[model samples]
Target: MEEKKFDINTLIGFVLMGAIMFWWIYSTQPTPEEIEAEKNKTEQVKEDTTVTNPTTSEIILQAGDSVTLAKAQTELGSFAYSTTLPSAKDSETILENDLLKLVISNKGGQIKEALIKKYVTYDSLPLYMIKDNNASFNINFGTTDNRTLNTKDLFFEPSLTKKGETQILSMKLKVSNNQFLEYQYEIKPNEYMVDFNIRSQGLSNVFNSSQQINLDWNLEGFRHEKSIRYENQQTELYYEKDDENIDYLSIGGEDDAEENDVNWIAYKQHFFSSILISEQAFDNIKLKSKTLVEDEEVDTTFTKAFYLKAPLALQGGELNYNMNWYIGPNDYQILKKYDRNIKEITNLGWGIFGFINRAVFIPVFNFLKGFIGNYGIIIILLTIVVRIIMSPLVYKSYLSSAKMKVLKPEMDEIAKKYPKKEDAMKRQQETMALQSKAGVSPLSGCIPALIQAPVFFALFRFFPSNIDLRQKGFLWADDLSAYDSVFKLPFKIPFYGDHISLFPILASIAIFFYMKMTQSQQMNMQQPTQEGMPDMQKMMKMMMYLSPIMMLVFFNMYASGLSLYYFVSNLLTITIMLVIKNFILDEDKIHAKIQENKKKPKKESKFRQRLNDAMKQAQEQQAQQQKRKK
Candidate 1:
């Protein structure tokens, strides 16, 4: 209360904040109307896709056998499987195609390579490679280079099945050191999951007969490169004991870092992999090892068992392996059911926060998603709920502010009484007394806001991984899935660069309005300390303007969704504050309460007494030092 200092530095900081906000608003003007139009366009895109049959392919599948192929590029690395089933009315060929880079099919059924293709987007680029445009998968059945290898006979041999009863389709491969190998496959119709069995008969015999039998199986024309990742997590290379062993793992090329990459597992790049589980333990499984053949004409055999393929050779002892192959998307609900830890593939938040994400945030978000199909709407609803939950604490903060306002007049009087004192102890004591009488703490408002910082940070982390919000439209934003820009600049600016986004502008405006409202309240009630001292009210007014400006400048490049939430929250807070200030808090009641407290002669706490004593001792010490110098 010794003359409240009006610091020039505070005013300068505020001006800078305002400048920043103005720059941002000028750059990113709002396109609220455009966002609505984009929403309409998104619906039309879905409708157009349904009407167009652009993916209609003419490949046919017979009743007893099945075939799978990829229709993208020369390499059919993706998968397209077809099987005909006899329904009561008619025969239908069930074809399931879905592509996800890193996932196990156990949760959402068998993952075919075809379904994992994801599209990339950029600010100014045309989408090339539309889905299902590969013309190369059309196979001439009897031709060797037909590319689309038929697994029908091997999996669904008509002679082995009954005429009337439905046969569950399957395929198995047995390789021996014998000159010729007989292969068979069974076919099942209208089924999503498939199991595999592969045996390398007489493996020890083949090992003894030949120097070494190199088993190299390639899922050619399956149109997909494998991705290594845990369930419901970011895609990263699988870690192994030896880092150098990465050379053996031939997934996709490093040059194509934008998409598929070399996973950590030694041999998991080419679809799913499993070694022939013989009673004998094998030493190692290598990837992309070059086996230079002196004679190029040697026959290479291909065997199919469900969605898997393996090369067979002769051996001394039979080496057999069994495995359930899962090739599917990283759908959390679907994968959690398999108990294979398959849900770890989604890019949910990581670390202790990740634990919170999985345990608390994800469940809450999923629940919200169930009710609101539109992700943008869901985020808005979620924000409202969180705000409501925190309302009580927020109200307390307002109460603290109101009480401080009531004590300002008395605080000013005490400051005037201590006009000539270099001893700050008396001034501090008077200020504390005023605060105690008013039942207000200086830090109460700041503490509540600080407590909510973690919640804000957690929400920031949660939104990006929320794929459900991708391509969703909110007010002035085109794709809540990506950045929403109203205009792109012809030239780049120094700190701000170019590219204007409307959401940030709207957010800045809202922030400014809210700050102005709050600042007005704080300023109008502010009282000056000494006669010559500058009013603290004016300095606070400058600060109120500055902070919102800083926010506007900084948040322009941030996600529209984040800015939207903040803008809405601030607006609501301002509304609530206004209501409380006008209808609930009255000056007469506050003054009466203060007078009542003063008449009662409230007892000081030990901490307050200690602080007052310390200040008094410091003031006396300084006075003694001054007297000695005189």
Candidate 2:
């Protein structure tokens, strides 16, 4: 059998195919070495982390103990029906003996129209309920939309303990024979947390059994009338959860047609989850669904806990629930100690990729933040550090682009010599040959740039979040948590909203200059493509105009800190590119290198030979079929 000769075109096709394969593999596949290292690291992490449990104790106050309801406003009833309403505004209440510190304000004085001040949930403005599973419980009476719910009418009482710690004053209320029987509050302190328990005396259990005592932490004047959406927000981290339990008991609420009604909004720095407790059992519960609100792209989980079988019931004798509340920074070190994975609330985003983000990106950010006090500075330092790490790849990419730049003249000549569409194929072959002779891959520069895209995007998502940056101001910016707009407009622009940010404008300008410098190198080459050269040029010009414009508009209302990071990174990249072009690349030496490659031994690749054979066989079959038809 005669040996098959490979066409240059065929070899180029194989090369393109190989490049696509390599890119696909590179994007998706972790190298075996990386995989092995990851596995070892995972094992080490597991070995290092020890499980710890967080527990809280409850205290029961005796009736004889004279408790000062320091912040008590009023107690209403005629011996039979009595209830204490907290004072709306008496600074700090000091409960002494039997006298209540009542800060009476006409604003909040009714029990039916009271407001819930401090019942903890996952969200800031959460819903209140008469009964846990009652469908009416879905109506959110949170303080919003010009509605004011006075804390006085909302809370029973507020008091400071003997230790000076703030505590809530509440009476054990019982309803019997169409009468409301109320008892005063008592406080006792213990190590770790303060707990207040009130007991009712002379009141018998109704229905000769357990009567579920439903307390009202009502939002008197609050109403939900609108929904909201966000272009960008904090990312939440998610964990693999078994969502088999029923968390949604009764999803009732008037659908606010306005897009502004938030199904759920991402709180400042916490995860929002809905837990469904049954009227029967309210204590023992299990995590149910890990969900994200519709159209909300958060980084972490929106989990719901379902009381295994309805809420734990309270026996008529008495019902007691010890709530553990955390009211400080969500430090992972402390959160992880609880073992509840409450630390996961620091929104990392979801799925396997989310795990990688939480396990990798977050830790890296935290580590870097330790040294770099300022977050903006940390971003800059991180960018420089990443560039340094990827320097070897960057050097190779620059060398390849430089080689292509040097061959522009010769490549232009080949294009001019072959104007016909058929000869256009032949011209491309010569260009490839020229590129190969120059010891450069046309695609080499592109791959490294592509590799950096993920890191860039990951950081973009990371910084807007990373609560450590919240309220931390760098320069002219006030709060890094929100956008640092130099000026606010009275009107809103579509998609962009109403604000003017300087950082994105500076960034876009840097990008423009960077693109301009890159394309300028190709300007000396006179040859153009066979078709649509004018259109390509037009597209390039359009990109130059469009990209910066879009950035200026989109980032005008985004966090200035994020925009600053991109701006600094772009400026740095431009400087690096300039350095490579000016100092590292020599056009004369590159041309000489190309000439040297032309004299080396050239061998036909087996893949190239196979491709040519396939193409030839296809041509032969097509010719035979045409002849038969004729």
Candidate 3:
């Protein structure tokens, strides 16, 4: 106040206080219409939110509430219900026998879960063929009220009855006091088959008799094996129609098929199946199957999903449909007992290979399993038995190789004599003559090996589908039916997979050594090479290495039992080769025998004589071509 002059800070504070006071006064005032509009906007959002999210009970009630009894009576005439509607509270009833257990829900009056009593999944949990909203069985029809109705949304009253060893569960959907739609399921002790029958009582007026009822059945196949990829590769939908051959969908991808007069439809998994068989054939059926990608959150427990829609014919005013459901292991003997050709789902193989597995391998394996508890020892015994049975053929093959080895020096002489490319035919003829004189057939080695191919292929089909090997463990393998991983990789390797399987690696190593031993024995044999022909030794060497690598890659994802069989088989073969080389076969004796045969008068068979004639003709033609060129 000395000079009555204000500083810059004091002037700024006065201006800021005046501006704040003016803003507060302006915000406190509002019009009546603006407040009403803001309240209306907030109410609108609350109404929209309520409409979007509804409770489960509300959804269930909506289905019934959408059509009142008065409206139904007006549209349906005398068929309308005057009683109270069924409750929406879902309930489940279980019907279990010694072999299987089924949970039936009131909502659809269908099977909500199916569990096999004797088997468990790969994770040691109870095996569920259908569960967790993955299966749906519904009947779709037009009601008297002209509304398309799906039986899945309606609740049914369930009743249980028992007679001796059979248990019957009946679900009834009442249309009136005495009229109803009924589902009767009968389960017997120690049986995997369930008898299912649908009957209608005095409901002819309520249903549209002119139209056929559509039965929609769907099931998602849960994973029961250790490898989801393998299980998916084996899962498929199979059906039989018109008492003819059984048909199936592609096992790899999504596919659908239309069929007529279907007798049964089977949802086949890797080791088990669920089949629906009709007493009277369905008129037409449409089936579809889809492979589910592996996802830990959603699909890790399932392999594929299947859908089937079949048409059932209704007669007079009532519908009576009879069917059976088989939910059990895919055992060949057990399925064959049904006599519906359902055993074809086992997929042992095709043609003679399948026949061998069915006729020979299955019986032998089962017989061995009866006495031997350990699968590993049984496999060893099986290998020994097979080798013993095939000893004569193996001996013949080895004898052929021995003859080639003993004659290597003379073969080299023949090769040296025909060094030029034009002399190939002459050298071949001379070699054939020498082989004939020595009583050795050039094809002897390959023919015996070829004869054993059926057994090999038969065993290839045997191990993977053998249910007994499913969870059996041996040595380092926790499950013989699945690949035995010694080490798991963080990343997948293109064709090799994401794990190192010990059995396949051991099998590959055995094969490599076996090839090495055989290759060394045949190294001295000389092959005549033409100008454009590839080097035989190099090709053979490449095959020796490439074959084992291929075995390692291909069998890495195959069943451990199969790889174990190969490993043991190869080791036995190598052992036999060593035994033959050391104690059974002597080079001196073989050479002496060959020399003795050569000294004798050589008798040419018709085949050898014909081959010699052909060689001469070829040589003559080559000579003529050379002259023409000159």
> Model 2 over residues 1-630: C-alpha lDDT tens digits?
999997899999999999999999889988899999999999988754642221110000111222312111111112112123222222233332221122211212211211122232223444231112211111111111222222223222333334354344443222332432222233323211113232333434321222223332211111111111221132221222232121122111211111111111111122122111111223322212222344322232222211121122333543344433232234444445543344555544444445645666667778998877887777677678766766666677777667777778788888888877545446656666666555666667678777776666666666654556655677887656456667777876777666677788888898788667655543433236566346555566677778788788877766667787778877877778778878987878877878787788655468545755666666567567768999
* Residue-level lDDT for 63 in candidate 3: 37
Each model's total of backbone clashes? 58, 36, 0
C-alpha positional error of residue 476 in candidate 3 after TM-score superposition, expressed in Å: 2.1
From the highest TM-score down, the ranking of the candidates is: 3, 2, 1
- lDDT (CA) per prediction: 0.45, 0.45, 0.83
- Residue 618 lDDT (model 3): 92
Task: Write the residue-wise lDDT of candidate 1 on 516-604 in tens digits.
Answer: 87666555345444445677777767777787776666555555677777777776777777777788778778778877876776678
How does candidate 2 score on lDDT? 0.45
Q: What is the C-alpha RMSD of each candidate to the true structure, in Å?
A: 30.0, 34.3, 8.9
Where does candidate 2 stray beyond 4 Å?
1-240, 243-338, 341-364, 416-418, 423-438, 490-492, 521-538, 602-630
Error of 3 at 282 (Å): 3.3
